[model samples]
Target: MKLFFSYLKSHCKTLFFAGTSVVIFCGIFALDNLPLSAVGYAALLSVCVGLVLIAADFLHFRKTHFQLLRLAKKVRYGLDGLPPAQNRIEADYQTVLQELYRGMTELVTDCDCSQRETEDYYTLWAHQIKTPISAMHILLQSDENENRSDLQDCLFQIEEYVEMVLSYVRLNSDNTDLVVKQYPLDSIIRQAIHKYAPLFIRRKIALHYQPVSFTVLTDEKWLLFVIEQILSNALKYTRSGGSVEIRLESGNTLIIADTGIGIAPEDLPRIGQKGFTGYNGRQDKKSTGLGLYLCRRILSKLSHTLRIESEVGKGTTVKIGLESTRLRVE
Candidate 1:
């Protein structure tokens, strides 16, 4: 009804002109002394013709409206679903749309190709560098000299950087090699602790770790990486004779607390962000700022949560919440 009214409004002037023309013709017939009944019949016939023309126009307009609506729906779903245009205007619009889609697709393809190439190059470079790093570690281990400890430390740092590069690459890969399974939480903790045992000895930092009786379903490799990162950070900032404690609290929260130069309050919020080196990192130029970022990301992927509490001149406590019930056992 609304559409009909709108159509009538648009054709009102044309209708008025047609009616006036009919009235003028009747007046001419009347001036020529035509019969009144004949003139009235002629006027009615003219009005009937005009009504038929208007109805035909309305039908055409209604059909076009519905067709355009359907086309809009198809375009909304997908560009490829756009139907063939019936008019020159729609054809021009479709041409522009197709060109835009093609250009966007090409841009995306180029980006993907470039990203794959970069990942491949770095992955290869990281592997190639590891050969020498391994050789150095082996050579340093054979040496019984007092400086061997320093050499080993340097080798460890190199290994850490290499691993960081590999991890960074893998994190952005299309296919993740994540193998999730049930593993003893204590075993994972011990592995991380053992990796840094030499560091603890060298720094004379006291380690206080107790075995937890719970098992967690997670990707052991990724979880170990997270644990190692947390442990490394704790050990890096702690002073000699200071202690690092590892404990499992209720609700499956694993706490790693260290008597280290703690994170500043303002800097704490941004520590998990990539490339965010806070006060301690600025003070210690060797800090890469990727450790916490990687840890947070990996933990999140494993459906775990990482929370940090710290105060300057006091200590830092890192809590990792592990909920085995959240896991899909299969």
Candidate 2:
């Protein structure tokens, strides 16, 4: 059988050496019984046979080594770091190594698929949770008295965090839920303004957008989420009577500038990390640290980029660069 020959190839060298040594020893022991010429001829024959066996053993090893290498190449595809081989032309070692390789590949693939399923579940959960959140908001709106104002504020905070969680979950999905197409940039800004109309009106914050007509390719819902997060952060930190302006600058970059307390230099570097509120959020414990983190994640999927510029006590401006312009045919 092929397997038997494969096994034999590895142990051939040892077997050949042992057999030759035994034959040589027997020849030496029986030397007096035979004629001197016959004894001499027998010794030469034994040496010649040993030499042939050694050469054959090496040739067989070379053939099997090539086969094992071909198998290794197939097994190593698509893996990052692989371990070094410990044995060459080894039957049991080869068998064990192959099994280990197959197991690792399966493990990585399964983990990726499981992660995706988990995200999908969270996305479904977010939608379901929104229904109850909407009902609560409606009930709060019916009683707009000063006593209910505090409760309303707390409810609003809960709604904001839930929306952020949903955005974060869908950020890294394989299929971008973006509905990208040509749309008036002004119209998109209007929608973003409408969604956060409550915050702007409540804090007496001014929402100023430059009047401009431009078309861009993007998913409307996700793009709005990115804008809302930036605007929300601006309004939260900006003192009452401060201004938050949305401007469409050159190079397809949309800037959201807030005249609120700005980020510290040390905190700026880690602003987009998940669940990281830094010094400002620490001061205001109401911060979930998920706003900017969700913004970064969603922007990345839309093929856009987000950049930040700020100075302490001066304020912060978050820029979202729409990159679909690069894909446009001139």
Candidate 3:
């Protein structure tokens, strides 16, 4: 009954005009000498009613034109800001708008999920490739040292680049393939330091590690990557006589400090952005700018926080906080 009243209100003016015209035509026939035919009068009245109804329907449908345009704009902007609809066709302009908004939202969500999976697959593939690469490197080691020395180094560099790519991809994984369990944090740090033993020795940088044994729940592989990146940066900036300190502070944090050329004040804020090396990196030209960025990303995924303190030409210290139920009891 409410719907019927709404329709009548929309066409009331047009209906009144049609009725007035019909009454004038009927009066003209009644007053003139022409015969008043009932069938002709009924046909003329039906035509007036059809025309008014068509006009009313057009006005009702056009009311939603602006709303439909707004929904289309939402789809173009790539935001999943609306819900889905069932029937797109045979619907009013507003209903079509709802359907479009819903479809666009679903499309964006699927794309986001697919993109993450692609990154994970790429990282996994890179890691898998390293196994064969290691085997090949081992075979080359059996040859005469002088003959294979240059080739061996080249292969090693390739392996490092592959690992770097994998680390970059894994850094942003929302569903990170991390197996967190209770493990001695110090053991992992020792293992990471040992991996870069040759580089530290060749650079002639003094290494200092304090025996602070603390256990935490964390992914070992990801933590190792963070450590490696920090060590690389320290070694890159430190002079031959400088010392790199790896120690624990307050039992919940791991600190790595180096007496190296530190970060510039202006560029410090941007250090962890992807591919952003800033003043120090551009000046040195050796930094990929990926190291610290990847470290920050991985640490964030693992629910850890990293902090940096530096003074130009003096040194820098990177501290990582690992807090979990698995932390050792005092």
Candidate 4:
């Protein structure tokens, strides 16, 4: 109804002119003492015809309006839904839309190609760089050099960063490697602990681990990466003589709590965000602000949740919630 009124308003000038002409014709007939009944019939007929025409035009307008709405919904998929042009103006608008659609399609294709090329380059670089790192590890360990332990630790950190580069690349790629199944929970946690044994010893941080004998449905490799990242942070912020403990709570929540330089209360909210490093990161120049971010992302992909609670001077507790994850019983 509102649209019909607006449409009538648009042709108000024409309607006014026609009404004025009818009034003038009637006045002239009256002044000449001519019959007014015929003039009244003709004016009534014209009004009825005008009403019918306006109703038909309103129906067409409504149909086109609905068509444009549906077209807007499908615009993301394609631009083939332009309604049949009803006038020269509508036809010109459709032509402009087609041109815009063509340019947008081309732009999307180019961006996809460029993104693939960049990912490929980085993947290649990560693989090629691993070879030299391995060689360096071999050289540093051979014959038991005086600084072998320290050198190996540094090399290990370098390897970790390179692995992070690969992980970051994989996260953004279309193809990701994840094989989910029942994995011994203890074994996965132990593996992560073992990998950082040297770091633990070097930092002189005590590890208190309680084995929770069970199986969790998850991707072992990805879960291990998440655990390792947590362990790395736990060890990084903990000072000598401090302790880190891994235990199970509430049957399905795995907790890694560290007696380290805990996170500030204000920084806890944004701690896991990508490229976000709070106070500790600023103090530790080597922090890349990606470990927790990667851990969060990987755990989420495994249908698990990551939660952290920390106090500035006390400690931080990292929890992996596995109760709600998708797992089928054997």
257 Cα displacement, candidate 1 (Å) = 0.7
Candidate 4 per-residue lDDT, tens place, 209-293, comes to 9888888888888888889889988988888999999999898899999999899989999988988999999988878799899
Which ten contiguous residues of candidate 1 have the minimum total lDDT? 75-84
Pairs that clash in candidate 4 = none
Put down candidate 3 lDDT per residue, 1-330, tens digits, no spaces.
Answer: 555567667778977987797778778777785665764777577888787777677565454444455656765764343333325643365466667768878988899899888996897899799888989888887877675755764675577678788766765556556787777888899988897786677668999998777987788888988898888789878999899999999989999999999998998888889889888888877667887888887787677889999999899999999876433322
lDDT tens string, model 1, 50-127? 779888989977776776677677653447555557699989998998888788878888999998999999999999
Models, CA RMSD each: 5.6, 7.2, 9.3, 3.1
Candidate 2 lDDT by residue in tens digits, 112-198: 899888987888888898899889888888976776766866787777777777766766666655677777878878887887787
For candidate 2, give the lDDT of residue 221: 83
Q: What's the true lDDT of residue 26 in model 1?
A: 79
Arrange candidates, best TM-score first.
4, 1, 2, 3
What do the candidate models score in CA lDDT, each in turn? 0.87, 0.78, 0.78, 0.87
Q: Count the backbone clashes (under 3 Å) in each candidate.
A: 0, 0, 0, 0
Return the TM-score for each candidate structure: 0.78, 0.70, 0.64, 0.87
Find the 10 residues in a row with the least total lDDT in model 2: 78-87
**Colliding pairs, model 2:** none
Question: 239, model 2: CA deviation in Å?
Answer: 0.3
